[model samples]
Target: MLKFFYEEIDFKVPQSLKTSKWLKNISLSEGYKLGDLNYIFCSDDYLLEINKQYLEHDYYTDIITFDNSEEEGKLEGDIYVSIDRVKDNAINIGVSFDIELRRVLVHGLLHLIGFEDSDDDLKQQMRAKEDECLLLY
Candidate 1:
């Protein structure tokens, strides 16, 4: 199941039902089943605190994903998204807010599905996957 929540913010995800089905299909396409995935939208400050406290990183990022999958072929996790960053990034990258937001949302799911962007090559691959997934949006 995919769920959406908010913290220190009041934003509603548009077309949530369609988005959930799209995400479930993406998970299945990647050879995994979608489990209890939670997307928490919050302000940059809220996310920064989470970063500093949980990740030991005192920086703001678009999204921070916590993988809680117990085994292979199952995707379960908490995806914390900074709405402030997403809006800024959307303007900086010259993309629509909706497009950028969906990209970040799926980017977190990609991480839970065993994709990483720690290196340039891996990042490129991850971006490609994100783009591919975005086509379904």
Candidate 2:
């Protein structure tokens, strides 16, 4: 089962498998499996602190993930999503709240299963994967 915790925020959004399906599909494509995942939605301030404390990043981001799965194929992680950033990104990308939310969710899942966008090529690939995951909806 997918579970989500709210930290520094109060949102009514439920854990969605339509979202989880995208993660599970990507994991399957890469020979990974989906395990129990914990998504924590929070505010910009909270996530910014997480970024600074864990990644040395002192800026706000849409999401942060920590993979805890010991099994190679099984996916597990603590995903911290910043709803504030998601909303802002939605505006910037011209998508609805749901679309941007799914993109951010997929982005975190991709990280748990080994996906990065630190370089130009990787960024392109990540964007491609994000779009592909969106198609699963």
* Candidate 1 lDDT, 87-126, residue by residue in tens: 9999999999999999999999999988999999999999
Model 1 poorest ten-residue lDDT run? 28-37
TM-score of each: 0.97, 0.89
- Winning candidate number (TM-score): 1
Candidate 2 accuracy as TM-score: 0.89
TM-score result, candidate 1? 0.97
| Candidate 2 local lDDT, 3-74, one digit each (tens) | 778898978564565666666776788787778888899999999999999999999999988988888778
Residue 113 CA error for candidate 2 (Å)?
A: 1.6
Clashing pairs in 1: none
Question: Which residue segments of model 1 deviate by more than 4 Å?
Answer: none
